[model samples]
Target: MYQASKQRYETMPYRHVGQSGLRLPAISLGLWHNFGDVDRLSNQKEILCGAFDRGVTHFDLANNYGPPAGSAERNFGRILREELGQYRDELVISSKAGYYMWPGPYGEWGSKKNIIASCDQSLQRMGLDYVDIFYHHRPDPDTPIEETAGALDLLVRQGKALYIGVSNYSAEQTVAIAKVFKKLGTPFIIHQPRYNMFDRWIEDGLTDVLTQENLGAITFSPLAQGLLTNRYLNGIPADSRAGRSSSPFLSPENVEATINKVQQLNQIAQNRGQSLAEMALAWNLRQPTVTSVLVGASRLSQLEDSLKALNHLDFAAEELAQIDAIVGK
Candidate 1:
C-alpha cells in the first residue's frame, strides 16, 4: 500500500482559484505526452504516485491527450481505482474536451452535443462520479458561446463537474463566455493557456480580463516544452523530447535561435542557485493571477528537480533585466 506523507501539503504552497474557494498546488502534473496508450502502464502509475507523494494533487488531462485518444484517462482510471481510491477527495482531477476527438461530427469543439457527450465519455473512462474541474478544450468559432456555456452549466447542475474552465481562449472570448457563465450562475473558475518565458500571449490581454473577472489562470507548458530547461543547452539529446519527439511546437528549427536564449537564462538561474527548469516554473508562479504551473516530466527525478523552484522565487532587478534582454517584449 502506498502511504502519502501527511507533511506533503506543508512543503508546497497552494493558490486559490480566482475568487473561488478551491485551492490548487503551485505545481500540477500534465498527462499530455508521457501517459498514453503506447507507454507502460506501470511506469505511468509510478509517475502519478510519485507526484502525489510530493504534493502534486492536480493532474491535468484532455479527452484527446493520448495517441489513441482517451487512453490517458483509461490509464488514470486504473490508478484511481487501484492506488488512489482512498485519496480521491484530496486530489483535483481535471479533463478537457475541445480539440478533435472521435470520428464524425459531435466529437469536437464546444457545442452542447460535444461538451455533454465528451464529459459523459470522460466520466465513463475515469470511472468517477464527477471530475473536480472540467474544461472546454478550446473556443469554437462556429458554435454560439452561449450554447457552450450552457453545456458547462448543465454539467455542474447534473453533478458531473464541480467547476468549469476554458482553455486557449483570448481575452475577448473569455469575457464574453464568462458573462454567460455568470448569468447562468455557473462558476467560471480557471483558464488554461500556453505560457512561459518565451511565450507571453496571455499577458497581451487575457491576464487583465482574468484578473478583472476573478478567474484563476493556470498555464500549461511553463517550460516551453523543455526549451527552458538545461536539456537543450549543448545539443538535443536523442532522448530529449525536442530531439526524439516530432512535435511541431518544439521542432529543430525553433531550437536553433532559442539555444542561445536558453543558455543565457541558464546562467541567470545558476546565479540564483536554481536550474533553468526551476526558474521557468517559478517565473509563471510569480504571477498573482497564476494559480498553478502545469508541468510534465518523463521521470520522477525531473519532477523533483522542478519543485525546487519553490525554494527561491524572489528575483533581483538586474536578473529580471538580464532575462528581459534575452526575451524582450
Candidate 2:
C-alpha cells in the first residue's frame, strides 16, 4: 500500500481547474518522456511515488507517450494496481488519444470510432474502470468536430471517463469545440497545450477563450522540453532529451536562439528566488485560465525541484516585463 505524505497538500497550492469544483495541484507530472518500457521499472516507480509524496496529484498521459507506444500507460497500469489502487480518489489520472496508434482507420484521429476505441484501450492499459479525463490528442480537420464531441459525450455517459478535454487546439478551435460540448451537455474540463516562457502561442488568443468559457487550461512542456531549464545553458548534456532524441522541435538552430533567451530568463528567475525551471513553470500559471503546468522529469530529484514552483508564485511587474522581452513578444 502507498503511504502518502502527511503534508502533501500543505506544500502544494491546488488551483480550481477553471470553474469546475475539482482542483488540481499547480504542478502536475507528465509521463510523456519517461516511464517507458525501455526505462527501469524501479526508477519509474520511484519517480511516481516521489511525485505523489511531494503532492503531485495529477498525472498526465497519452496513448503514444512511450517509445514503444502505449507502454507508459501499461507500466502505469501495473503501478496503479500494485501501489496506487488505494489512492485512486486522491489522484486525477488523465489520458489522451488522436495520435497514430494501430494500423487501419480506427487507430488514429478524431473519428467517433477512434475516440471510443482509444478510451477503451487506454482504460485497459491503465487498468482502471474510468480515467478522470479523456482527451482527443489534437484536432482532425477531416472529422466533423460534432462527431468528436459526441464521442466524448458518449464516454462520459458510458462511465468510461468522468470529464473530457481537447489538446493542441487553436483559440478558434477551442471555442468551436466548447460549443459542441455545450450542446452535448458534456463538461469540457481542460485544454492541454505546449506553453513556456520561450513559447507563448496561447497567450495571444487561446487563453482568452478558455477564460470566457470557464475551461481549465493545463500547459504542457512548460519547461519547453527542457530548453527553459539550466540543462541547455552551458551545452546540451549527453543525457538530455535534445541530445538523445530526434525531435523536430529542438534543433541546433532553435537551441542557439533559446540559449540567449534562457540566459535572460535565468537572471529573472534568480531575482525571484527560483531556478529557471521553477520560474518557467510559474510563468504559465500567471495566466488566469492556467490551472496547472504539466512537467516531465527524467528523475525524482528533477520532479522534486520542479514542485518548488509553488513555493512563491508572486511576480514583480519588472520581472514580467523582462520575461516578455526574452520571449520577444
Candidate 3:
C-alpha cells in the first residue's frame, strides 16, 4: 500500500564500491538500534519508508542486531512483506553473521558451520530468498581465515548472498582474508569499519589496504555512536542514549571527555551552514576509499538530518585542519 517517491533517485548520489560493479548510496541506513522487538513496529516501518523514499537503497543488519537477537531482522521482514516488497530489486538489503546468536558454541564466530547456519537463519528471519550482501560481523581470533572465507564463498555459490564483506577487521586481517577471497573467486566487495571524526583507527592503515585491494569501505558509526552529534552539546538529555543508565558504551564520563571537542567542531559546522552530524558524515565520505557512510537513526527527523549532509559534502582545507586539531589529530 506504500508508494515510494518517484523522484527518489534525483537527490541521492551513488558511488561504486571500490572497483566492484555494485554501487551503494552515498549514505546507507543501518538498523543497529531502535528496530528491535522492544521498539514499536510502526516507528520502525516509518523510518524504513522514510529512508527508502529518500533514496536510501541499502539497509544494513546483523543477526545480533536486536537486544533479544534476530528481532531486527524479523521486524524488517514484516516491513519488507507489507510495504517495500515490490521494490526489492531496487534495494540492496544486507545482513551480517558472526557474534553470538544462540545458546551454544555454534551460535558464534567464523566457523563454516556458524556462518552458514547464521546466514540461513538471517534469511529466514528476514523472509528473503537471498540478501544483496552478507558480512561476517567480526574477526574470530581462533578460526582459520580460510574457513570463514570458504563459508562466504559457499553462500554466494548457494545463492544465499550476492556479495560478501567483513566488519571490524584490521588492516592486516583484511589483507589476509582478501587473499583467500581472491583465490576462491568470491565477490568479496567491501569492508565495514567504525570510522568518524573521533575514531581514526581505519586511517592508521585500513584505508590504504582497501584502496590497494580495490575493495570498498563502508564506515559504520559515522557519528561516533552519536558522540559527534548535537545530542550532547548541551549536556546529555535523560532521553538520549548516553544519558540512559542502560547504555554501557556511551557513558557520562565518555561525554565529558569529548564534549569540549564536540562543541568546537559544532562551531565549524555552523560556519559551514550544516549541523555537526552532517559535517561528521561528510568528513568520513571525504575519503575516496570510503564508498559509503553507514548511519543509524531512531526517528524520521534524524534520518532527514543525516541526509542533509550530502548537501554540503565539500570541505575547505582549513576546515579539515581545524577539525583535526580539535579532535586532537
Q: Which candidate is the best by TM-score?
A: 3
| Residue 240 C-alpha lDDT in model 3 | 87
Best by lDDT: 3
The window of 10 residues in a row where model 3 has the poorest summed lDDT is 240-249
Q: Candidate 1, which ten residues in sequence have the lowest lDDT sum?
A: 239-248
lDDT of 1 by residue, 1-329 (tens): 77887877779888899999999999999999788888888888788998998899999999988767999999999888999889999999999989999888888998999999999999999999999999998899999999999999999999999999999999999999999998999988999999998999998899999999999999998988778988789988887667756666777777777898889999999989998999988889878899999988777887888889999988877887788799975
The number of clashing residue pairs in model 3 is 0
Q: In model 2, which range of ten residues has the least summed lDDT?
A: 244-253
- Structural similarity to truth (TM-score) of each candidate: 0.97, 0.97, 0.98
- For residue 116, model 3's alpha carbon misses the true position, in angstroms, by 0.4
Which regions of candidate 1 deviate over 4 angstroms? none
lDDT of 2 by residue, 1-329 (tens): 67878877777888988899889998899998788898998889889988988889999999998979999999999998888778999999999989999999889999999988888998999999999989989999999999999999999999999989999999999999999899889978899988877778898899899889999999888887778888899877776667766876676667776787888888888888999988888888888889988888879998889888878788888888878877888
**On a 0 to 100 scale, what is the lDDT of residue 269 in model 1?**
94
Query: Model 3 off-target regions past 4 Å?
Result: none
Q: What stretches of model 2 exceed 4 Å from their correct place?
A: none
